[model samples]
Target: MNNYPFGSQAPKSFPAYPKTEFDLESGTAIKRTRKPKNSPFHPLRMIKSFGNRFHHFFKLHPLMGLFLALCFVLALAMILSLYGTQYGVQSGGYVKSDMGFDDYPFSKLQNLVMVAGHSIYTSSSCGKIEKEDSWFLESYQKNPGQAATFVTHIHEGIEIVARDDSALLLFSGGETRRDAGPRSEAQSYWAVADSKGWFGKEESVKWRALTEEHARDSFENLLFSVCRFRELTGTYPQNITFVMENRVGALEKLASDQGEKLTDVM
Candidate 1:
């Protein structure tokens, strides 16, 4: 009966929460939502976060990574090669080879050989011909058996080698004049040279009168003398002194360029 007395009373009520909807019609359409945070250990996050770290991991660990690195290197090398081939290099620059010899050193040079040339002597065996036939003929005839030319040149070379005990003198030429025989022109002049002597040093002068008999032109003078120089010294001559008349600037320049190109082709 007591329970029935409260029939008109209502049951206990629960708390209600307000709705959180946006009102687009009222200009409040935007709403904020929290982003899902990335894990510090995830694969995508690791790749995006570290550049070199990911690259190094790929490089050292797997065959595919090593192959890719090698491919990249090869591509870079090819690009550089193409660039160098296009531009090449400038002219007249000194190129040093790994095993190149030093130039002839005049001061430290021992066993020095100076070859003073005369067109008459070089062409003597060919017999007399037109003035135009010999390159040095006109100059030789003008100077005419001056002996002073070779004498003066020899003196200079002697003075250069006087202090060094190892030096030797080399006289080079052939019998080019019609009056001359096949006998070496170097020997003929050197005999006259032996009698006159070198100022007070005739002993020094007589001891070093070696000869080379095959030079026909200035080019031959240099080339043949160099061969002779090499043969006597066991090694090539350390220094070669030349005494001649006129413009030799072109001679050496052409010889060096053509020689290098020809050598490369071979």
Candidate 2:
């Protein structure tokens, strides 16, 4: 009988199995060389690789990518809207109080034309005064003809200022009504004047026209506008011509107390 090892003789015709080499000096088996298995969950490298793959997919299918991007944006906008209601946000023209009043350029102007706001007017879609409501129904019924008076006052103030280049026209009133939503009577009058194009004197008077949006009554209208005049021009107005609907004796007393002259022109 052959004396060779039985298992070793059976493998001569078959492929020879590769043997692992060892370092004789260190006595450690050398590992077989292999290409690493691509792992999908590598912490540092997975994100970058996934981004690259996504970019490639988008490049291949652009229309689907655009639609997905738009959908994501819309979802984000909806989420923001849900948070927006928790905070109250109002929109309108903001009145700036800190206008560098000390550095006002029109300090030489000493003449003033001030118009008092009496009522808030909202003409109907038909453009008739009879269909409008002026803040309160009782007040509107008491003086249903005040719209023409308001327009006349606005035009007269504009004409006075247009005749004199050195005069500044000021509209004075406050947000007195709660239902008006912080809309000032002064701003309302200024809007009416603006809509009417300053009654054909826009070029001469528009630049000088401004609003004092914090006077509750006629005395405040006169007193606050005097302060506003000083703030705007850096000096008190030398000659104040008030264009108001009614004569206010308190205005005369205020002018006397301030050692200033007050003139009423209808």
Candidate 3:
């Protein structure tokens, strides 16, 4: 018999049974699980676990740690750039200025013997252009151009010099190459002009061509060519012309010497 109200919610009661455990296919009681003392639910334990992971990462790759440190420093630099100290016109900048046209004594010369120094060949032009043909490199390396870019200026110089009656066209370069034999750069230009037909008045222009050997540089080319010009004409050049990319300064230096006169043309 139950001791509970019939019409109300009744209190639960355990069924009468033996004190010994019953077997469901020889079953037994199992222990229940408890919460870990250092679980993620504990804030300090979670912090410690994260710190350990970071430490393990650094220990695995020292280089990776260094890379992270460098990134941090670079980020700092980028942030600092906002202060205008990193970039501005007045803050560590570069600008270029041009050398404008100014009159030079060589600017008025008639017997213009344009001596373009080794800057055109044996140096700038030769080393830069690798085209193994008539380029300054191949020509100077194998056989020197009758005049090289020097001839280009020489032709220009001759045009100016031809304005007068007495003008000599001279090109100078030594046997810089072993295979080219004993021919100087001057002789090569003479041959090319003679062979190529010197533009109508071939014989007349060919008579004006001269050669100067032993000039290894621009100064030597100018000075030696001047001496050769004086020797040929039996008088110093009344008006010496220098045709160059930029000839004023160089011509100034040469013309300022004792008994030398020159005029510069761009």
Candidate 4:
């Protein structure tokens, strides 16, 4: 018994490690730990990965992406072009009248009756102007009625013309509304006058009644009508009568500044 080298005591045994499992048929080791759960930024990571993948896709399909981009640009350009044309028409784009300055019959007219337009009439027939709805109702609330005031303006204009047979009557306005299309306020007033037969002086006033369809405001109404009178008659009016509800002081100042004579028609 004492023949052993370490004969005094028996050797202590060490603890045994657990055996790693493996597939017996394939001889592959099994996974011991599960993959860590994705972090809160997993979606961002996935988007980055997708972007890289798409980058590769674009590299492989460059022609398709370029075509799609070109198509988008063209569609945007078309939309802008259409919008620009529509806006141009609504904002008083160039329009030629059937009657030119050479066609004006009264070349020696020196007096002018300028009526400023306030609203666009909806009706096509001038006879129905009284029944037509105007663009703005608030501006006409202080008057008897929109249509009544409009008729009164026409009457006043024609009365001035009837009083003096040498005066040229001009209605001034521009296309001011998008929904109203390209119809000018000046045209509306002239149509109403025509429908009313120049308020009983059709014989004397019809030939002299004209329109300045490019004026956008009160100042333009005064200034443009003068210019139009010159263009038609080849001379500036010796006396000017402005028919409008407001802006009399401004018109007077404008006339004074421009060294033009304006007669207040009460």
- TM-scores, all candidates, are 0.43, 0.57, 0.44, 0.57
- Candidate 2 Cα errors over 4 Å, as ranges: 1-102, 123-141
After superposition on all C-alphas, the RMSD of every candidate to the true structure, in Å, is 21.0, 16.7, 21.4, 15.7
Compute the lDDT for candidate 3: 0.55
Error of 3 at 165 (Å): 1.2
Per-residue lDDT tens digits for candidate 1, residues 98-125, read: 2223442222224545454564433344
* Clashing residue pairs for model 1: 123-176, 124-175, 124-176, 124-177, 125-175, 125-176
Ranked candidates, highest lDDT first: 4, 2, 3, 1
Find the 10 residues in a row with the least total lDDT in model 1.
Answer: 257-266
Query: What's the distance in Å from true for residue 164, model 2?
Result: 1.1
- Cα lDDT tens digits, model 4, 191-232, are 888878777899988888999999888889998999899878
Off by over 4 Å in 3: 1-112, 115-132, 135-151, 244-251
Model 4 TM-score relative to the real fold: 0.57
Order candidates by TM-score, high to low: 2, 4, 3, 1
Q: How far is candidate 3 from the true structure (C-alpha RMSD, Å)?
A: 21.4
